[model samples]
Target: MERGFRLILAASLMLMLLDLCRGSTIGVCYGRNADDLPTPDKAAQLVQQHNIKYVRIYDSNIQVFKAFANTGIELMIGIPNSDLLPFAQFQSNADSWLKNNILPYYPSTKITYITVGAEATEVNSTSLVVPAMQNVFTALRKAGLHKKIKVSTTHSLGVLSRSFPPSAGAFNSSFASFLKPLLIFLAENKSPFMVDIYPYYAFRDSPNNVSLDYALFESSSEVIDPNTGLLYTNMFDAQIDALYFALAALNFRTIKIMVTETGWPSKGSPKETAATPDNAQTYNTNLIRHVINDTGTPAKPGEELDVYIFSLFNENRKPGLDSERNWGLFYPDKTSVYNLDFSGRGSVDVITGANITNTNGTTWCIASSNASDRVLQSALDWACGPGNVDCSPIQPSQPCYEPDTLVSHASYAFNSFYQQNGASDVACSFGGLGVRVDKNPSYDKCLYMTTGSNKTLSTNATAIPTTSHSLAGKVHTSKSSWTFMISFLLFLAIDSIRGW
Candidate 1:
């Protein structure tokens, strides 16, 4: 009996760890500043379809809160700048606002963070931010949700006076009074300091100094900060570390940072040549990959960071440059502006025409031509075993078993694992043995699995188990650790059954 109980406990722990490991750190800012945008329900569905798990909105719309209820997607809702004075002065007002806009839908809505006033410094309302945040915190405390739903305000990068050499980063003295108290509030409450980091603006302002490649996270060259001797690879990290240094300077290094907004516009005025669909795709794609991979900044290597991509849909009402209205991943019609894998594993193909049903373009993974048979076989074994790829279709007497070559077998398994994992670039990279191809490699009766397709076949050419291959690609495991845990669990189950 004791042994059986122990086995059950071990299984439970493994399941919990698996749950913790399977989620995306990337989120999208669901800004509805356009009349053409889809309804809140439709928007929520769209977010889920792409496997995106987090969302940040500009306001606490009850409709949005209701639409997202029980969706399991976490939300970071905002309290608008205009409401700051009232929320700041009156705890009753904050409490009423929360009770009406938040409490009714929360726990079901999965609302996590409450951002009070976005970029208050930019709006010249910095004075109201901290007080508003305090009142909101008080309201949450009264409702016994102070710990669950954190309160913070978003700041623009303009808060920093010097962000060049990341090590020498410091907040502007003009905003010192506002920042000091704000940082203290955040540290005391164990909340994150939310900031909007826009590399696009930097590149736009100084095209000569800021390399486009650096902003897009595709730079091969490194920028070494002379002061700290820290090597910076991309502008995103440098920008983030700048804030990190600033926080440390204020002796508030304990406060975690969350990227409240970041994205590139798909379209811009003629003068804003850098804003294009291609650049936007590359920037957001690489941004997702960077955050999900946990490749932290030079100052904080491998630290977990949560980021939200700006503007889920193009907002026609947003003021300023033409680019201001075009920073959207999707059109109001719910079609993708361009292909993007929120899973951070692979590239997405650009969507065209009215065919919005299949957003995942024709992409496949195959054994690399340069890879040796030994390497192919090794990868095949890993994919079939530890990789959790469904390999029954590649067995003898199966449709895919005919060619019988190591490459052929490896290709089938690699594609299965790749497609199962949202057709990500990293998923197909079986230790550099697998490669992604645009052309479909399916020949004869062996139908290969592609992203957004559920036609996995076996010897009988019938559909195999597909429950594991969710659109979100939530299940993730390391090569060795996952295998060991699974094997141990299996052993435990068998032993427990026998003992019973």
Candidate 2:
């Protein structure tokens, strides 16, 4: 019984630690392909208000990087498709570009990863990206930032040979020549595979064949991956598992996959119809809920799946169909393109206008709550991206084995029971106070926890708390008790994981 109790206690702490290391920030792609958009400075303010910590952009935009500097946001930089050939051909250019574009504004701006190309495989310049990526990696190694800044390229799902029934997922034969080598590189360097997944596109192409409810994430129509005998209720999750299954089939289970882009367009053209603000809002809103709540898909149950919504704002100048230019939740002026409430994580809705600005407090709270750990850990996890898993909502599959919170606790040497240590309290703190916690409109009270220390939590402790550490570890130590504290520190130094 004592051993069992110890096991339970250790498991609880591990759960708390895992939760502690997670990030709530929504990773949004900031495409500056259009000329008409907020200046990077104003954009930064909008981003800061939303508390977005991860921002991925095409090309190393100095203005964009500068705008985000010191805002405490992490960036995934990019090398444009146009720069690939030159970068590949001229090693010096890659080095020079890094010095000129990347070095000057990184530590302060927090450039985490450099995406070599956006949706590389399906694009016209597909052949060039692989070599260009090599050049960038080589440049990074030369510049001594290779270890600090991850090297990766995002791909469109167009490269997938088969995505349906998810387990049957296979990479296109054409990409195998490029992909196998790329996978080896990714595995070698510990970089993630980024892909832009849009279930809306699949539905748009074959609405008659696809079920709208499943695409919309309405809990009715269920999806199943036949190969794995796993059920996927929504297409977004099925799409993700499909990639995993495909990669696994290729003998690569460890390569982390990130949804570099996944979102719905709020507007569209006649021939490319199906875009509407409501549908876009529903898609994005549901997606946001799925991620923030640490919801998981059927294949990787309970594993938070990291995903980045397609865009920060609409790019008016994108060269494509109307839908291409319309996949934004906000207009160019920073105004929200739709009306929605994130259960009080701050509301997103604005009248259509050219120069409007929207600030999202709730989103930022959720995002930063995870990033605001000890700087060293954030510095590590924030390298290019998060654990890269944003759990989905509505329990897409049977829950996987719950993480060994007990082992985690013992591993960290946490000397407290979950209830005594306030584990649930910490978990529940993710709502209100401008933080986005997934909610069902039917219930007034959401997932909550009783506090440790028998301290009566301030009524507003969960939302608008008096201090950030009401639940999590708050006090480090104090002055005046110098000798006693010194003795404790010495005792703990040996036991703490950082030291151990």
Candidate 3:
């Protein structure tokens, strides 16, 4: 009996460890800025159908709060800039707001976070941010709900005066007065520093320098941060690392960073060639996979970072460029803008590759940007040796050797093997370290071999086609990917760059 009991305890402990390794559910922001959106109840139902457990609304809409009641969905309510002054001057106002907007819907609605203001530092409402946050916290504490719901605010990436090289990221000197007190309050309260990170904006503003693949999380080329010697494959990780460095500079290293907004627009004005349904689908799908994989940024490896995708439905009335109103994953009628699985619990799906315009006979397979060096090396060894692929092209004297990093070399060899073996998923995936692309990976003098025939590649073992919006007969067999994977593989935690 004693031995049996001990075995049961050990099994339970193992299960707990597995649970910790699971990927976190992805969250979405619900901004009701459009006139044609579905009703609150309909939106809540749509969220539930998508298996999304987290949602954030821009304001404390009573209808939205009531809609989420008993839905088991975790919510984050926003306090707009308009309420900042009132909440800052009088804690009583905050108390009243919470009483009317929060307390009544408490446990049933699952309010997990309350954002005091959005883009406070960049907007004119900078002065009231800290005071407003403090007042809200005080009100929550008085009502005995402070411990239940976290109080925080979101800032735009514009808060950083210097973001290049990531390690040099720092808040603007002009905003120092506002940030110093805000950081202190956040540190004391154990609230996360929320920031809106948009790589699309960066790419659109300066397409000459930023690699489109890097911004879209589809790049095999690694951007090494010179100061930290850390490898960054995607702009999202680079952006977060910049914020991490900025926080460390402020002596607030322990304050966790949460992504309040990060997404790609499906439509944009003429100049914004990068924004399209294909690009949006690619960026967001890869993002979901990255999050579920549990791979933290290069700065903070193995850490679970909470993230919320920009908006739920496209807001037709939003101002700015065309892309501004097209960030939503869903249309106004509750239909998905593109095929996406937030839980990341599906087969390995590959959207548009390097070129979305023309994908026919040619296909290129390369190393997954998300995989670690150790994993890439293991796969690289197999691809060069027993995989029966030509790797001499990646040697020191060869052209592909210029940017000769582990990631670059491995990608070349992996593609060689993939092209040689029919470009099938099984041929490319050297222990899950390969990704098949439809575009050429060759550049300059380094020529990657590609499949010339127009033979249709078998999709039997690859991802299922998920473009359809009608879910009348579809079935889900696997567990939620968010609840199973450990971390993303893009940002590997190099031993040398661990503490920097």
Which numbered prediction scores highest in TM-score against the true structure? 1
> Candidate 3, residues 1-500: lDDT per residue as tens digits?
85566456555644663555444446888988989999999999998776577888988888998999998888989999988999999989998998887888888889989999899876778899889999999999999988889999999999999887889988899998899999998898899999989998889899887988999999999999899899999999998989999999989988988888888999999988999999988888787667755677898886566778878999999999999999999999877788775534333223223323223566777788888877677667655653434476688798778787888999888776565444566666565677877665656656565543243333322222332121111111112222211111212222112323
lDDT leader = 1
Expressed as tens digits, the lDDT of each residue in 1-500 for candidate 1 is: 87768777767766765654543367889998887888899998888776666889889898998888898888898989988899989889998988887888879999889999999889899999999999999999999999999999999999999998999999999998899899999999999999999999999999999999999999999999999899987999999999999999989989998899999999999999999999998998788778766677899986667788897899999899999999999899999898776555452222212212322356788998788765566667667764656687789998789788888888988887777566666676665677887666766667666554332222323333222312232334322234333433444354445556
**Cα lDDT, model 3, residue 300:** 84
Any residue pairs clashing in model 3, and if so which? 23-482, 293-487, 293-488, 294-486, 294-487, 294-488, 295-487, 295-488, 370-489, 370-490
The TM-score-based order of candidates, best leading, equals: 1, 3, 2
> What is the TM-score (0 to 1) of candidate 2?
0.68
**What is the model-wide C-alpha lDDT for candidate 3?**
0.75
| Shift of residue 96 alpha carbon in model 1, Å | 1.3
Estimate TM-scores for all models: 0.74, 0.68, 0.70
TM-score of candidate 3 to 2 decimals:
0.70
**Number of clashing residue pairs, candidate 3:** 10
Error of 1 at 396 (Å): 24
Question: Taking the tens digit of each residue's C-alpha lDDT, what string does model 2 give over 1-500?
Answer: 85566556556655654444453335778777677888889888877665566777777778887788887777887887777888777778888898888889878889878888777776767777777778889988987888989998888888898888888888998887789888998988989988888889889889897776678776575665555678767898888888888899999999988788888888889976668888887887777656655466788765555577778889888888899898876788888888543221222111221221223211111222233334323222221122121122112231211332222212111111111222333321212111222221111221122222232322322332111111001111111122222322322332333332
